[model samples]
Structure formats: C-alpha cells, structure tokens
Target: MQLRQMTDPNLILFDVEAESKEQVIKQLVSKLAKEDYLESEQPFLEAVLQREEVSPTGMERGLAIPHGKSTAVKKAAFAVARLKTPLEDWESIDPTNKVQLVFLIAIPTNEGGSTHLEVLSTLSTNLMRDGYMEGLMATNSKEEFLSRLDIEEKVKSNSDKKYDKTVVAITACATGIAHTYMAAEALEKAGHELGVNVLVEKQGANGIEDELTPSVIEKADAVIFATDIAPKQKERFAGKSYVQTRVAEPLRQAKEMIQKALSNPDGVVEENDSEEASQSSSSSNGSGGFLKDAVQAVMTGISYMIPVIVAAGLMMGIAKLGAMPFGLVNELHEAKYATHSNELFVILHHLDKFGVLIFKFMYPIFAAFVAYSLADRVGLVAGFIGGAFAGGLHHTFWGIEGIPSGFLGALILGLAAGYISRFLNQKIQLSKNFQAMKPMFLIPAISVLSTFFLNFYVIDPVFGGLNVVLRNWIESAQGTGDVVLASIIASATAFDLGGPINKAAGAIAIGLAADQVYPLTARVLAIVIPPIGLGLATVIDKYVVGRRVFEADLRVAGNTALLLGFIAISEGAIPFMLRNPLITIPINIIGAIVGASTAVLLGAVQWLPLPAFWGWPLVDNLWAYLLGLVVGASFIAFANIFIRFAMIKKRELAA
Candidate 1:
C-alpha cells in the first residue's frame, strides 16, 4: 500500500503547539486514539518510548518518525503533525537539527511478516528526497498535505551506464534498528552514484527485507556483509568472495568499501576465515581478546543453562522441605540420600533424585550451546560428547580410567569441540546429493569420535588433575582463617556478575555441594551480595542524587534489580555495572568480599544449592547470613551514592 493510503485527513494535525518530544508523542497518540486507530494509548506510548530509548528516530532535515508496533494499535495507521515550535534536546543524529515534521506510525504487534518494514522502507526512501520533504512541509491544510503525499515521483536509475560489477550486500546491527536501514540506504545511494548495480538486504528490527535469492547471490560479482554480529545462514556466503566489516563502516565509507571490493575481488576471504578474523580483529586492541571471546562463549552457555539450574535447584529445595516432616533433613544432608517407610517421603526422595539427574547435565548443555554458537549445528554432537566425557560418562575409555573433569574441563572441551567441528566444516565438502547427510551423520560421527579420544587421553587428564588440586586447596582453606581465599572466591563471583567467572565459581560451589560439602557459606554469599548491593545502590541514588538522574528506564531497571536480587540472580546488576564500570564494579566487588567474608567468619552454613530468598530458612546461622547481606549492601549503597553525587557535580561544572 502507498504511504498516503495509511493516513486519513482526521489524523493530520496542522500548526501543532508542543513544547517537548514527549508532548508531541502524547498529542499524536491522542489523535490516533480519537481516530479509532489505537485501542489503548498507554501501552502503545510505552512501546514507542522504549524504542526511543534504544535510539531516537529523529532524522536529518527537521524530520522525526516516532513509531511503535503493539497490540494496542487497532490498525496500521500514520499521524502527521507540523510543530509550531521546535523542541530542543531530542536525540538526533545531527544535534543541530531541531525537528519540525513528525510522522508517528502505529503497527499491529502480532502482524506476521514484513509488511511494516516494507512501509517503513518506502517512507524512509521518500523522506530522503529533498523535493518530497519540502513539498510536504509546504502544505497549508490537512487535505493539501494528503494530496502532497500522493504525488509520487519516479527515481531515475543509472542502469544505462555500463558498470562491470554487480554487488550484493547485507546490513545488520546488534539491535537491528536505525543503523541497519541507514547502512542499506548509504550503500544503495553509493551504488547508484557509482553506476554499479547493488542489491542490499536489510536485517532490521522487523526482520529481513528484500532477502537475496540464491540466483541473485550466484550472479553477484562480490558480496559485502556489514554487521556487528554474524549473519544468520552465514554458510550461504561460504564460497562467495565477500568484504566483511562493522555495520557503521558502510554509513561512513560506503563508496570506498565498494570500490575496494571491485578492485580486489581475490582479497575477499572465505566466510569462516573472515568471521574468525573479524571476531579476533575487533578485540585485537585489548590484551584480553581471546579471554573475552572465551568468556562470551561461556556466558552464552550460562544464559541458556540458567533455567535448568533454577528449576533443578528449586526442586531440590522443595525435597529438603519434604524430608523435614520425616525428621530426615540432617540425615539426608549427611548421606546425600535417604530412605523412608512413608510414601510421601519416598516420593520426595525420588523428586530429589530426578532434580539431581537434570542438574548433572547442566554443564553438558552449557558446552553444547557454546559450541553451537561457535560452529552452528555441526558442533552439537561433538560438544555434547565432549561435555559428557568431561562429566565422567565414559571413565574407562580405551581402558584409561579418569575422574570427572568438572567445569574447567568442560570449558576446554567445549571450545575444542567447537573448533574441531568448525575445522571439519571448513575442510569437507560433499556432492549435492550427499550434502544433506553430512550434518546428520558424517560431521557428527567424526567430530564426536575425535572429541571423545582427545578428552579421554589429553584434556581430561590434565584439567581433571588441576581441578582436583584446586578443590583440595579450597577444601583446605575451609575452617581456617584464610581470608585471602575467601576474598578471591567472592571477588571472582561478583567480577562479571553472571558471566564466565561467576559461573565458574557457581559450578565449583555446586560441585562441592554434590560432594557432601554441606556449608558453602562464602560462595552462596557471593551469589547473593552483588545483586542486593546494586539494588541498594539504586535506592540510595533515588534518595541522595534525586530521581531525575535515574531516567525512566533506569528506574524500571532498578525496580527489576530488587526482585532479581532477592532471587539471587547477580546478573541484575549488569546494566548498572555497564553504565559506570569503574565505580559500580569496584563497589560491587568490595560489597561481595565483605558479605562473603562475614558469612564465612560467622560460620554460616547452607546445605541446599538454591540461592533464592525462599531458601533462607534452610541456612545455618541464618541471622549471620542476613547480617552479612545488610552490612555489605549498606557499604554498596553509601559508596554508590557518593560516587554518583561527585560525578553529577563534575558534569555540572563542565557544563
């Protein structure tokens, strides 16, 4: 449908008097509601505001396209307005440009397919034309404005020129918002100027638009992938000569990149090689490039593994509660198992066993997904086999008996499995008829077999031995006044929130619990302190620094942190940490150390692996645990408040 068809005369507002962007949006939404285009205003307004937070839609030449897709929208519609006064401080790519023309678009939230995207693309393209925008702005009335929108002008093509290159490109960004479409536009404009035929596909918030067909890809002279993350179905570009770079690069230097691609076609690396190098090069400036990638892979695994952990942990906690009626709590804690004459107790014991069964596979799932992220589907079997082997699934592989390799070994084997599968994928290419069987049989058989032997003979022995040594050291530190060890565990657990290091500490704690180490006081405190501390920081900020500094989203985040913190999810603090890592991270670490050390010194004991507030009743020396949380959270609150006040003062002085 045409852009003009989506709007009505009643939806158009002339000489709109709005002082701020919020007022402008509210006015437009009110109009939309009045016109029966929106069923509810609040939800639609919230969705639009949330989108604005990610990146503002204010474009160049006094234009702003504020849009939202939600169930609150009764129909796809547009509301146009001409502001009587320009609003300052609205986020725009060009800060000097004050927006005068507003186009508010409302789309159905559940609308399947790329209908909204098509409309957006068309509207954005037309807005780029100086004549089209000027004509619309010149309209004196709603009918005139609608008439101006109906006057479509044909875009002259430069296809008559004899250009040798036919380029196909894909553009994507992390959020798949403004930059994705902007890059596509830039590249297309550049292609037109250069008299080269270019087909640009946009992978944006709505999904892929103008997707490249196999025939188009096969006929293209070169491919350009502009993305911050790896493109989906990346294997499609496997054999094609391609230029890969960050999404923003095209917006900045599209002509230069295109020229370079045309000139040096042979220089374009294979898809896998380019991706690996891209990942490496992006982090090359830092010494921790490999470490960051490894952490990212593990964190990907952790995010997927969390639901399993929570479910199993809660089940075990309930089982403990069930055993209490039979007076078998202490016995179950000691023996890690119990039998009772009561049928209810028997069922609880079975539930505990079932939870344990699911829990044991956590690391394996972690390993498999980590590999999948790295090498896609081919890595699944290999990663799972490697992780299972690490978990001591086949202790006597080839008559070489070994211990369970634990999390450390799982980490190593997971990466190895991914790389192994990646290597196989790169090397092997079957005929078309046999290609379908490769992923199902050939790749899995070879990758799993290789990973199995490697883990059993090499990785397991080395990491398994180191794992034993580390556990013994930690065990030895227990009951001793080993402040250093306690502090280290606490710091590591809080360092990355729920990233690799935190997960590593958690894995160790869980392992120890399985081994009949009833009281993992320090580790449990570490898990709870960071999130609680950060939540306290937000509360303190509201009182000391004022709510204006928190913004709408940060306030929402702060509220979320409190609930998540109570549930022992340290990841709740990640947004705060990311905002001011220098200040927030150090404060979190200090709070974690204080809480963990206090818990250990006070002899707080926790039998269950569950970390939620509901499990507090199961802790030994419960008062001490609560006291540690209060003390550490207080430290975080005070420190955070002071730091924020100082920063705000500094900014004011600079202003």
Candidate 2:
C-alpha cells in the first residue's frame, strides 16, 4: 500500500497529549481504530507496546516510530500524532531527546512479511532526510502532510568530495534507531570539517545500511565502532586499529575521537590461538580483564534481582504488620501458626513463609543472571546449579562435608560458571546434524556438569572461607558497637546508590536480618537518606538558598526524588548526583553515614523490611529515627548549596 493510502485523515492526530510511551501508542491505536483499520484495538495496542518495550522506537530529533504486526489488525495502516508535549523516559537512543512526533504502524499478520517491510522502509528513509522531516512538520493539514511524502528522490549532499585521510566507522545502539543515525551524521559532519573522508555504516532498526566493504576497510587508516553493544561480525575489523565508545560520544565529541583515531591508528588485534586458549584468554582479559567483566556481570544480576527483592520484602512486611496486632509477630514463622484458628493469622503466616521461600532464591537468581549476561542461556543453567550448590545443597567431595557458602560463594560460583560456559560455547562444535542439540542439550549439559564440579571443589571452598571471614567481621563490628557497623554499611549503600557496592551492602543487610542480627534499620535509613537529601537540596536551593541552583529539568526531578525517597528508593537520587558527582556523591555518603550512625546510637530497631513512610511505626525509636533523617538531610542540603555557590564563583573567576 502507498503511504497516503494507509495514512488517512481520520488516522492523523494533531497536538495530541500523552504522558507516557504507552499512552501515546494507545492514542495512536485509537485513531487507527476510528478509521476502522483494526479488528481489535486492545490486542493491537498491546502488540505495539510490547514491540516498544523490546527496544524503544523513539529516535533523535523528537521522533518515534512504534509499529507491530498482529492478527488483530484487519489491514495494514499508519497512524500519526504530533504530541503537544514530549514523552519523558521513553527510552530514546539519545537520552536528551524527548519524543514529540509519533508514527504508529499496524499491519495484518499475513501482510507483514514484505508489505510491511516496504512501507516501513519508505517511511524510515523519508524520516532521515532533513528537508522531508521539516516539510512534514510544517504541514498544517492532513492533505499537506500526505503531499510532503511524495518526494521523488531523496536529498543528496555535495560533501561527498574526496579528502586526504579516509576513515570508516560504524554507529549502533541497543535500540538502533536514533543514536545510530545521529552518530553517523555527527561523524560525517566532523570529518568534512576536518578535511577527512568518512563513510559511516549505520546498523539501525531498519537493518544495516551503507555497508562498509572490504576495499573501504583496507583503504581507511582507522575505524571507529561507536556502540552501546558489540557490533555484529566484529571480527571483520580484526587487525585494524579501531576506537570503541558509546554511540552518544560521537554526537558530542566526534572531532576529538577522529583525531585520536588518526593519531593512533593501530588497534589491538585478536590473537590467533587454539579454541580452548582463545576462550581462556577472552574470559580472563578480552573484555578489559576478568575484574571489569565480573563487576559488569554482578551489576546485571543485581538489576534483575531488585524487583524480586522489593516484592518479597513488601510481602514480608505486610505479613509482619498483620501478625503484630495479634501478638503473633514471633510466631509468624512457626509451623503451628499454619493451623491457627484465626484465618487471617494463618493467611499472613503462609504469606510470610512464601516470602521467605522467594527470598531464599535471591542469591540463586543473582548468580544465574550474572552468568546469563556473560554466556547467555547455557550459562544460566550452569550458574543456577553452582549457586544452588553454594546455597547449602548437600555435597560430598573427597569425603569432606560442604557447608552453606552464602552470597559471597554465590558470587564466585557465578563468575566461574559464566567463564566455563563461555569457554564451552566458543570451543565446542558439533556436526551440522547435531548443531541444534548443541544449544538445547550439549552446551547446557556439559556446562552444568563442569561448573558443578568446579564449584564443589574449587570456588565453594575458597569463597566459603571468605564468606565466613566476612560474616565474622560483621559480627565483631556489631559487638564493638552499632555506630561503626552502621557507618560502614551506610557508606557502602550510598557510595554507588543502586550500583554494585550499594546492592552488596543491601544484600548483606538482608542476610543479617535473616539471622536476626537487626541491621535492617540502618539499611532502611541508608536507603532513604540519599534521595531525600538530594530532593531537599533542590527545595533549599529554590526557596531557602535564595536562588534557583537547579535547572528546570532538575527541579522536575526533585519532585520525583521526594516521592521515591518517601518510599525508600535511593536510586531516585542518581540523576541529581550525576550532575555534580564530586559534590553530590560525597554529601550523600556523609548524610547516609550520619543518619545511620544516629539511628544506631539512638537504638532504632526495625522488625520489618519495608522502606515506606508507613513503616515508621515499626521502628523502635521512631522520633530518634526521624531526627537522624532530618539532621542528615539538612547537612546534605547546606553542603549542596555551598558547593553550587563555590562552582559559580569559580566560573566567574575563570571568566
């Protein structure tokens, strides 16, 4: 179908209002339904939303293209919307850009194979042209909009002129829409300005375009791969000096990157080795060494683990709340409560048990996902098996009884399993006939067996000892006094906010709480203080400090931070901290330390893991806890103000 034929007047909306990506998709779907383009709107809407979630369609320059193919659509069609305001947190490839123009594509399931591709290709190509986008945006009526799409030929640039230095670059992103093209454009412009000939191959949602041939690579002095993810067929650039960076870097500093590439054109080449040796080297040093890879793997696990932790923690808190009034708080975990005459008590008791069961899987999930991040599905099974073994699964190796190894052991097992699986994946190759079984059976079966033996013999013993030392140290700190222990935990929790260090401290606190050590109170304080402190700083900067230190975007974020802080989400402070990390991060850590120390000194105790404001009543010294929070937040606010003023004065002096 032609562009105009699919884009009817009824399917085009002007100045549409939507607060979120989902809402925008729904609105566009509703418009398509009004034109009788869909057999069912809800299914089509869901399909579109699912597609958007897989990788946001939001591109640079205030544009978004959300499309789906489903049986719910009776005909292939297009729905367009010009948003009155931009959609924030829409996962644009360029984070700085908010989506203002949306194109929604709906295709019949049967028609998607080729018809859909053709239409999408046409639209995507037209969208990339500046004159076409400008003309479309300037259109006042549906007819005018349709007429703008009638361009016979795409725009061409005369800057294709030859230059002395030739370079080839690839620009890609996870979403492969906005940042890919934006980086390509930026590099091209920068190359022209610097009298360098640059040809950029864009790997975008529409697929690879302007592919770099072997001749081009041979002719180019150097190459650049600006991507968030590793580009497909990366070995193609082997032996060529290449500069790697996040896609957005080129958009901001293309000239500097080009200069660096020119100066040092010889990049590190992958070594030729036996498959086994290659895998070993890759696991140890290929991706910036084992330490960096381990950190990244652990962070990936934590990102997935947080949701489960939050859900289970909330359920356990609610269960405690229900049992507290009946004087059954301690009995909530007892088996006798399962048969209690009071139905509510029994239900709460079961919920508490269920929460505990889920909590038990926390380490296993963390370990499994870490391996999965490194070695995909095969590593998942291996990691889970290793983690389970570490989590007190009975095992007899060389007649030595193994004990529960805990979180630290799980961390080691995860890394070991990931490397083992990655090695097997790279080194092993089956006959073509059995290739399918390799992924489904051979890889998983071998990886699991190998990881299990390694963990049982090597990783478990080493990390298990380390885990014991860690636990003993924590116990010793607790015995010395609450202040020291609380300070340490608080510092770790605030140091990286929701990052690896923060999650490690939080995980330890959860483990300690399971043993009835009562460090959750300090953890709860650490969780709330950073976000609240940052939010309070923004308010103080606006009203009390007698100036608006924060920009409009930051002022908006302050409100979100306050809301999230009340619910004990420390990650809400990340955006604010990123702006002035040197100032903001130190103040946040200090605030957390002060708050945690004061809470512990005042004997604040929490029986529930809930971080909500309503959980205040669960604390032993509620007023003291509140006082600690206020004092810590006050310090953060004043420190932020002072830092901002100092920065401003420095800028003035420099000027």
TM-score of each: 0.66, 0.53
Clash pairs for candidate 2? 241-267
RMSD of 1: 7.9
lDDT of candidates 1 onward, in order: 0.69, 0.70
- What lDDT, from 0 to 1, does candidate 2 have? 0.70
lDDT of 1 by residue, 1-655 (tens): 5777999999999889987888999999999998899889999999888866544577656888888899999888889889888765565544345889998989998762455666666666666554777888888878888887754433235445666678889888655655677778778778877877778888877778789998988788877878755455655555566666667687669898787667654333234332222111112223453554454456556545655655555666577677766666435533335465566767777777776666667667868866765676678778887777755667545565445665555677888887777667766666766665666777788888888788768876676565466555555665555466677667766766655456556677677678875356667777777777766665556346532244333444555566667766565555465445678778888988898778767877776765667678889889988888788777887787777767766765764
Q: Count the backbone clashes (under 3 Å) in each candidate.
A: 0, 1
Tens-place lDDT per residue, model 2, 1-655, is 3588777777888888887777888888888887788888899988887675344466667777789999999888888998888876565544445778888889998877666666655665555555777787788998888877666631126545668998789997655655677788778778877988888998876678789997888788778877654454444554556676667788669998898778853244342222222211134322454555565566556545545555555667678777766766656889888998889988999898886666556667867877875665657888887667655554533456544555555677887788887777666766666556655777788888887687767766665565455555555676666788888778767766655456556677888888987558777888888888877877666345434555433555565566667756565565455345667778888988898788778878875776657678878889888888887777877787777866755764764
Query: Which candidate leads in TM-score?
Result: 1
